[model samples]
Target: MNQHIQPPTSTASSRIYDILRKDLVGGRFAAGEKLAINALKEQYQVGLSPLREALNKLAAYGLLIQENQRGFRVPRLSRAELDDIAQMRLALEGMAFEQAIVHGDAAWEAELLAAEHRLKCADMTLDKDDEWERLHTQFHRTLVAPCGSVWLLRFIEQLHDQFDRYRRLGPKMPVIRQELDQQHHELVELAMQRDAQAARTLLDDHIRKSYDVALQCFLEHSG
Candidate 1:
């Protein structure tokens, strides 16, 4: 019989934290799944302390719930809560897009163009590389990076993360990709022309459309 040896690596707490975060955001953990600390410690080859720390971090991010004597589990999404999140995203992202149009300079325009080019080269297929998803996110972030409001960006990022799991689940929808690309093109074009009103309208519509699709998918799947 041959014995297997594992490689030594980074701090258990950080490693556990990163892995859990990725899995939570990717929907691999699934919503409302119980997170048993002992099982996690065994799976990650870590101790209870590191597993607890990782769970605490996830709870802080609203991705997990730490109940009294019940341990941790994935957070549940209610329809009302989802609607609130969507509305907030629309308001914040719409404002950011408008401000970017007003405040963005030539350098911002250049960056936006470069980002768009990178996004265009991204593989949008269902089996696309994870790197493409990362770049796609960066390109969208770059579009509104000139907004100059830290709180606004923070809120938008939170909404983006919450929405991303559903987005990934429905990537194979043709209408999703077609509408997304069309909206991105229009947004970039309007921003380049510094048309604040048109850009904001497009941005609002783009965000709302995705929210609607995600909500529909979420409901269907949950049912």
Candidate 2:
């Protein structure tokens, strides 16, 4: 018995786009795996048109790659591509953090402090803690919230999204939690002290460490 499926509206496409974006960024899809539209339609309970629209939007965001006649696949990860993204993050985030140090006021410091506190309080016992991810992202964003440039913030966010996909591709390690927490503590202290030079240096090292971890995991998995 054939079932009648209603045509998808614009809202359906937008909803599907958001869901698909989250899955891609969350590493739900394997790297370089082709997305079979029929399979997705069944899995997501979405029609063909909305699924295609969502996939096309993801392709435009560099989250998916479109082949000539092969439909879309998750973008493959590579050391070169990872390095490029890290370098860009270091450069741009460095600029924004410096400006934040120079211009951030008491309120900004307070917000950053609160965010860091919440991040520290996040439970790490669970393997996939949504609270931790949210608080961690909040702390980083709050650290540079006073950069005073909308475009800079937007670009930084886009770069972070790309980097996060790589990071999530790797298995989460519990051994690094203490070190990461310490780094975040120091970053907060440096920002509070308005030590731009030290803060920037620490931030660069922090970012590089994440890249190294992602690269290591990538090599191990690929090998």
Candidate 3:
């Protein structure tokens, strides 16, 4: 595992932040699980200060919640949270897609197609490999890149980071994740055709279905 991980070329704090954030998103710890500083120090081979720096950063990202004296824990997940995120994605990303269709140039179209292709060709089992997460993010971001709203794009990316932890811990497994490839491909297709109604419908269904599956997974495991 260590062999594949790139050695930190930046500050030790930066490396710790990157690695810890990935683990949080990867479900290395369950939601709301306590983050033990002593254990983490031994796990990542880092000093106390740098570890604290990393923890503080993750808390800033909302991946971890920090308590006054309790330190940090992975952010808790809930059905209500999922619903809110789904609706926000539907509103924000839906608008981005509509705007993209209106203003999308040939370059935007090409990037969207390319993003879809990369996702298809990559193994994107959400629970398995981290590369899949990067590709998945790229594909979604590319779809809305022509929307001309920087703030919207930033919000979309932040929401995706929040959404990822749930997906990683979900029980739908690799097979169900593979099935999402079709939805992704069709989203690109509808975007290319500039069919806003069809595209938004599909996008809404896509995000909602994903949340539904993840919610079920959480319930099953939590029970």
Candidate 4:
């Protein structure tokens, strides 16, 4: 079994990167917590070089902060940062949604609705976090799949990842599943109706509401 292991610099770094990225996003490691090298080596079962490489890659993805001499730490949560991400997401995703509605074909429409349905049916309890996250991300991605700009999709994806981290790190949300499901239905209906302005407005509020929940949750937890 040991004979199959790849060298530390090559395969090991990729493996460590995947685990660390998931851990960071899933809030396994607390935000702003320093990543000690010796501790990580024991936990992840990797050499120093591979661990550093993995951490640096996460830093590039905005999931970690790497400082000189201080080493790596998870990005800290802040109300100001959450507001900034929401603003950016509103503008970028609104533009994408408009373009997608214009450029999307019938198949895209079908897939978009399908993704929404899957999300509605998803098991989003705390125990099924990874599965819930994947479905949620897919549903949102389907909304903008026909924007026809690779760069735009990439940027939005990165923002969504960061924003999602904030959501997960916060305490349990105030919005229950039924209300959320209704909002999702409304969004899909508006998109299907080609009501770009209404849909964008809904999306903006949809995002802001989540941010508000995150803010409230954070404040409550802090208190």
Q: What are the runs in model 1 whose C-alpha is more than 4 Å off? A: 1-16, 45-47, 123-129
CA-RMSD of model 1: 6.0
**Models ranked on lDDT:** 2, 4, 3, 1
Which 10 consecutive positions of candidate 3 have the poorest summed lDDT?
Answer: 123-132
Q: Write the per-residue lDDT of candidate 2 for residues 111-171, one digit (tens) a residue.
A: 9989888887774453646568668778889888889999999888778878888887676
Q: What's model 4's lDDT at 26? A: 77
CA lDDT of each prediction against the hidden true structure: 0.77, 0.83, 0.81, 0.82
TM-scores across all candidates?
0.84, 0.86, 0.85, 0.86
Q: Ten consecutive residues with minimal summed lDDT in candidate 4?
A: 172-181
Q: What tens digits encode model 3's per-residue C-alpha lDDT throughout 6-55?
A: 55533899988989887887788888788889999999999888888888
The parts of candidate 2 lying over 4 Å away from their true place are: 1-8, 123-128
Give candidate 3's error at residue 109 in angstroms: 1.6
Q: Highest lDDT among the candidates is held by which one?
A: 2
Using TM-score as the yardstick, the better of models 1 and 2 is 2
Q: Model 4, range 1-223, lDDT digits (tens) per residue?
A: 7778866587889999988887787778877788899999999889988888888888999999988754888887777887888899999998999889888889998998899888877744434468777888898899988999999999999898888777776655545434555687788898899988898888888887777656764575456
